[model samples]
Target: METVIEVQGLTKSFGSFKAVDHLNFKVAKGEIFGFLGANGAGKTTAMRMLCGLSKPTSGSARVAGYDVQLNPEKVKQNIGYMSQRFSLYDDLKVEENIRLFAGIYGIPRPLIKTQTEALLEKLHFTEERNTMVRALPLGWKQKLAFSVAVFHQPKVVFLDEPTGGVDPVTRRQFWELIYEAAAQGITVFVTTHYMDEAEYCDRLSMMVDGRIEALDSPQQLKEKMGVASMDEVFRLLARKAKRTE
Candidate 1:
């Protein structure tokens, strides 16, 4: 498979503090890549740089074949993002939100209607098309937010803690959607606090103290660390952080 995202010696600094230190990784096309980390581990910062939301202090990253620093706009065009905050207009109806994102992603005006209908139908949201986004249940809102993020059919989608605060059933359903997207050739880059979720990825990278401390398939990581599960692997690695001292 083709490499869709490449990071080489990527670093980001906030004045005297380093948020991402000499990071390096690559994400393959259509692969589900999980990025795991405890709070302040720099997962968000690294993802922000990859998504072109923040500038890197040194080194380089190519996302969807566009240099993050040199071609931020082009990079943005080829990627979708669903933030942890569930970015959507609360006051807007479901259909309106879908149309809004379709326009923002530069989808042709003529195709927006068809695309919106298809998306609503696929997610079983056709009945709620006219309902205000804020009126929907939390799980429905989350699913809708994800659908809107990927509606433009970008090559890669960044999901930042996409299932935060959701019930187990909702998370399971959300992962099903993720699998469907990956099957259709969209590379998934996700970060999550849940170890169970981490195990579902094709591969995972665990970050500690602004650097990736472990990068491997969950099974490999478990074997390498001599652990029985991702929860144990994460606990052992995360405990090594200096802040935990």
Candidate 2:
């Protein structure tokens, strides 16, 4: 498979605090790559660098085959990012929010309209097109956020804790949406703390203390660590790291 994201010795810092320490990884085209880490494990910092929202203090990365350091604009054009606390204009109607996001991407008005119809239909949101965004349920809102993120048909979509705070059923639905996107050849790189959610990805990288301690398919990681599940692997690793520290 082709490489969609490539990071070598990636590092980030907030003053004296190092958030990401010498992180290295590659996400292949059409793959759903999960990033698993506890809170403050530098997942958000690494994602920000990949999205071109923040410059890495050291190392280099290429996103969608464009150097994030040299061509941030180009990288942004080819990537879609959905933050954990993503906001849509509450007063705006569902379709309105889609139009606004599509406009921001510079999509042609005609194409935007067509894409909007298709996306809403795909999500069974056509009935709520005229309803206010704030009136939508949590599950619907999460799905809408995802639609907006990839409205411009970006090559890669970065989802930072996309299913945070959602119920189990809704989370499963959200994963279905991700699967649909990956099936269409769009690469998905998501940061998530949910061990069960990690199992849905094609592969995962588990981080500890700003460093990647394990990277592989869920089954492989489980087998390597002699754990029955991802959650156990995470706990086991976290405990070992704590002991070392």
Candidate 3:
């Protein structure tokens, strides 16, 4: 497969603290790549750098073939983002929010209506289109946030703890949306603390103390560690971690 994301010796520091240290990894097109770590394991920091929200202190990264530090605008143009908190305007109606973001992503004005209609129907959200986002259920909001994230057909989508706080069924349903996006040729780079969710990735990188302790498929990591599940693999790696959060 073609590589869409590449990182080499990526590092981030705040004075004496190294939030991300010499991280190196590559993500292929259309792959679901899971980034797993404890809350303070630097996953968010790394993600911020990759998403061009924060700059790296050293090393390099390229998203969609553009250097993150040198061409962050280009990188941003090719990617979409949805955070754990579900980023949608609570005051805006569902259709309004979709139209706002579609416009932000530079979709043509004439095509927005046709695409929005298709999206609303596909997600079974037609009836809710005029409803305020705040009135929607958590699960429904999650789905809509994800749908809007990939609406512009970005080459890569960054999901930061996208399933956080949702019930198991909702998480499963969210994963289905992720699968659908990947199937449509969008690369997924997700950060999550959920062990079960990690198993759904095509490949995973386990971060500990700002470094990747293991990077492999879930089954391969389990087998190499002489473990049976990702939960076990995570527990063993996190046991020696200094940062608990």
Worst 10-residue lDDT window for candidate 3 reads 236-245
Per-candidate local distance difference test:
0.94, 0.90, 0.95
Give a tens-digit lDDT track for model 2, residues 1-245: 79999999999987987889999999999999999887777788899999999999999999999999999999999998888995678899999999999999999999998999999899999899999999988778988999898888899999999988899999998998898888888999998888899899899998888889899999999999997988898888776454222
Q: Using lDDT, rank the candidates from best to worst.
A: 3, 1, 2
User: Which residue pairs in model 1 clash with each other?
Assistant: none
Candidates 1 and 2, the one with greater lDDT: 1
Q: Which tens-of-lDDT digit does each residue in 120-216 have in candidate 1?
A: 8998998999999999988899999988888888899999999999999999999999999999999999999999999999999999998999999
| TM-score result, candidate 2 | 0.96
Q: Number of clashes in every candidate structure? A: 0, 0, 1
Better candidate by TM-score, 2 or 3: 3
How many clashes in candidate 3?
1
Error of 1 at 188 (Å): 0.4
Question: In candidate 2, which residue pairs clash?
Answer: none
Any idea what lDDT model 2 has? 0.90
| lDDT, candidate 3, 1-245, per-residue tens | 79999999999999989999999999999999999988799999999999999999999999999999999999999999999887999999999999999999999998999999999999899999999999999999989999999999999999999988899998999999999999999999999989999999999999999999999999899999999989999999988799655
